[model samples]
Target: MEIIEWWPKIDPTAKEWLVTHNGEAVAPDVLTKIVAAGGSLTSDAWWIGEEGPDGFYLSDEAIDWIEATANGEKA
Candidate 1:
């Protein structure tokens, strides 16, 4: 599966715009409106990488962060 980052808007109550293939989306709410108005999917390069990382080199802090996020604990 591809890694995609979904960034919520600053207002926290607006629509979400999808940035394909892990692209950064500033002002995602506005971007979502624009994309919908344009009626198309505008995205950057689609990176086809190898399999996802197997946590082989994940540090203790990384593991903790992942676990916390998995449990829906806010930072």
Candidate 2:
């Protein structure tokens, strides 16, 4: 899956959130968690992937975490 980091300051709603990353929809619980986090987040980057569509990104540390997870390294 591709990871997309959302710009928390500029985004405040689920539709806005989805449009920013070009996504269809996400669970309310997930969106709640994302909004609950403060701005300029340094971790908990959003993970994304689509069929023949877009790529994604995450925080530097989050990227490391993703790599480790994909590589099967325990946290």
Candidate 3:
């Protein structure tokens, strides 16, 4: 699924956490939801990737999507 399509399906808390954390590793539960929604956890090209000890991080695309969502854009 597209990130925009799955963005809303994520828990509200997860959204808040991700937005607040920005470039940091996402919470495990949130990461699970993202993966289940078909998000890429291995492709740095998408800006989302799994770093060995650092965990999962969102790229500019994810961040931009969140920001647009927050601004009331409909995925």
Candidate 4:
């Protein structure tokens, strides 16, 4: 599913973290929420910029999407 479709279903903490951290690596708990909300880390390039022992980084597209969404715009 598109991030927009499932964005509202993610936990408030996760949403806040995303907004606050922006380009930082996404925490595991927040990643869990994204998966639970129908987002994919591996299946789509839109979700991940890089992944390794460090953690997941949101793609530029994903970051922009979140920013736009947080700003009350249709991403």
Candidate 5:
């Protein structure tokens, strides 16, 4: 599913973290919330970054989606 579609379902803390740390690697706990909310990590249009020892760095598209969401804009 698209991040937009499942955004509202994600935990509030996760949303806040995404907004505050826009370009940073996503924490594993937050990523869990995303997956639970139906966000896709394997989708080409969704997550598109490397998984390293630190965390998942979101793709540009993913970052844009979060920014738009924070601004109350449609995806």
Candidate 6:
């Protein structure tokens, strides 16, 4: 699955969380659904970084696929 394919499967609050904390470490469960839907940590969409004692952190691509989708672009 691609980034576009996984975006909609993500929860609304999860989307907000990613936007609000674009480069921060998040709870594993925070991205559970996303990963399950085939969101990639190594793809242009995001990357898995140092694992904190708390959990893992992720940084996504510069292009905001979520916003693009919201703006009526083809995902």
Q: Each candidate's TM vs. the true structure?
A: 0.27, 0.27, 0.68, 0.83, 0.80, 0.54
Better-scoring candidate (TM-score), 5 or 6: 5
CA shift of 7, model 1, Å:
10
lDDT of 1 by residue, 3-75 (tens): 1132221223322222221123224354354344442233331322122233112223433443454456863
Best of the two (1, 5) by TM-score: 5
lDDT of 6 by residue, 1-75 (tens): 565577678888877776666666765676787787777765554444556776666534423554455567764
lDDT of each: 0.31, 0.40, 0.71, 0.84, 0.83, 0.63
**Predicted candidate 1, C-alpha RMSD:** 12.4
lDDT assessment of candidate 1: 0.31
Show model 2 residue runs off by greater than 4 Å: 1-56
RMSD of each: 12.4, 10.7, 2.8, 1.6, 1.8, 4.0
For the record, the alpha-carbon RMSD of candidate 3 to the native fold, in angstroms, is: 2.8
Task: Write candidate 2's Cα lDDT for 7-71 as tens digits.
Answer: 33324564344444433334444445554544233443344222233323334454454455445
Clashes of each: 0, 1, 1, 0, 0, 0
The sequence of per-residue lDDT tens digits that candidate 4 reaches over residues 7-56 is: 79998999999999998888899989988998877676455688867888
In model 5, the Cα lDDT at residue 50 comes to 70
Q: How far is 31's C-alpha from truth in model 3 (Å)? A: 0.1
Ranking by lDDT: 4, 5, 3, 6, 2, 1
Name the lDDT value of residue 53 in candidate 5.
75
| Alpha-carbon runs more than 4 Å astray in model 5 | none
Best by TM-score: 4
> Candidate 3, which segments miss by more than 4 Å at Cα?
40-47, 50-52, 73-75
